[model samples]
Target: MDGTSQSQPQPPEQTPTSLSPSAQLDLAITLALHNWPVLSLAVQSSWGGPTSADKRDWLCAAIAELFTDRPDTDAGDLEEVLLQVMNDEFDVVVDDESAGDVADRIIDLKGKIDKGDLEMVNKLWEDWKQREGKASSVGLFKRVETNDEDQETDEDEEEDGEDEDVEMEDAPATRPPREVIEPEVDEDGFTKVVGRRKR
Candidate 1:
């Protein structure tokens, strides 16, 4: 046996004032929102903007990336942090069910984004916003079609109101189907369709 025993090295002491996961997440979200233009855009896109769901998806991905390099991080812990920070930062109330879905999407998008070119993420967001803006406005420019035959039938019924027994010979013969009416463009650049005429 050796006369002198070897001593093990001491581990570094951890500070007692370290931030909790929620606090850390809060700080991260705050910084990103303020300093990162893309994150701010992502947050804005979440509010009924184009590719809203996709933006949310990317946001979760970015959040996942934030903690991926940290030690002792778990999916559930990350999700809890995400839900708390998102609720606080976005000023929106989300139910537990939706939080779970958001967490799942975050994990999935993180994996996909990891495998692809990160630069494309911003481009994708911009393109989606433009495309969705135009597509969503389609309803404003498009016109709804009405069946002319139905309208004509309605008119005839009104003309024969109380004379259900009117002589068939005296009554005008059934007319051919009315011409298909096209929508007229107004001066305001909107399509104007004639509404059903009242009796």
Candidate 2:
């Protein structure tokens, strides 16, 4: 056998978690720049063209995770860089979906960051993260609108009850046990039916 030195396979790269925050950001941005162009391609082995959802999801997840380390880093500016890379380099227009929303927020954040108004950004991030955390804890598909609508309806009922109480003072307190009276507002901005009883 001839003694020929074989080339050794390179080791896998280190993850950003092992690096400093700034370095982590730099690494993420570098990787994003490199990988973004292929983001739309190979989603489903498109003989026609790359899919938008795959690319959008990839970029959004990358940017979101990239900024997870928030201290002493201009996350907004970094996000702006991501947007610029996608738009300027990739020439992709992202106007709708979570990625677009994230991009819009990043644009807003860039302005605040430039003005040194970090408190607003932090507050917004906190609120957004809180909502995202709660959404994650529950099944994301679960409808939270039910709870919100119920709460709003409860408030409306309470307000209506107050008005009813004022009107009921002159009337008898006891009514038919199965019958209920309520106010119904019409499209004309008027309560057309007041104290209408169910048959």
Candidate 3:
């Protein structure tokens, strides 16, 4: 060690205290969206057109704006917005009831933020940063299909106690199989490959 060497001061630990209430709310919304498995799958699979990623960013801003514009917004209102967005933007009808849970979490976070408590927001931010860009292990949901014919058949089977030995099978897939489109060449001779659902 040199005699004239001096120790450098370490930076202070980062905290959410420096963020404004609106910004904190925005962060909470973003993190909430990130943790949503349905939205994650839609974005990963590009269900919302070619700009699915951009749509997610737009959703975060829109949600934050909703809270700002209407302070009385509750979990129900949030859930409606989430459901509409999924349907309109990603062509996804969310029947798993996870939207309500996500809305509740966001509403709870906003309430805490209103009271100047940022602990939850900070923890979520830290967790998101730690796992950014990583594939989520959360299991995806499957859509249930039902019809009058199937229901009548099920009832007839149940009446005779003939359904007892039926083994449960895997749920039907939620999405159609994607087929890669033929590569197209641009004026600059660049090739673009696109994936679309097989009809």
lDDT of 1: 0.42
lDDT of each candidate versus the true structure: 0.42, 0.41, 0.71
Backbone atom clashes (below 3 Å) for every candidate: 0, 0, 0
Top TM-score model: 3
Task: Please identify which of the two predictions, 2 or 3, would achieve the higher TM-score against the true structure.
Answer: 3
On residues 1-199, what C-alpha lDDT tens digit does candidate 3 reach at each position?
5689687885454445655566667667877888999999999998887778777867876777577568899999999999988987788899999999999999999899999999998898668646762232111000001222333465588698776345122111234645556789999999886665442
With a 3 Å backbone cut-off (N, CA, C), the pairs that clash in candidate 2 are none
lDDT of 1 by residue, 10-71 (tens): 54422111333332232223223233333344466554245443334444334534564463
TM-score-sorted candidate list, best first: 3, 1, 2
TM-score for each model: 0.28, 0.24, 0.61
Residue 52's lDDT in candidate 3: 84
TM-score for candidate 1, residues paired by index: 0.28
Q: lDDT order of candidates, best first?
A: 3, 1, 2
Which candidate, 2 or 3, would have the higher lDDT against the true structure?
3
lDDT of 2 by residue, 1-199 (tens): 5899888986443232333333323333322332333433423333113443434434443453445435344545554655554554344444444344444555455455545455544454344336556444232212222323433564587676655344223221222334455767888889865653332
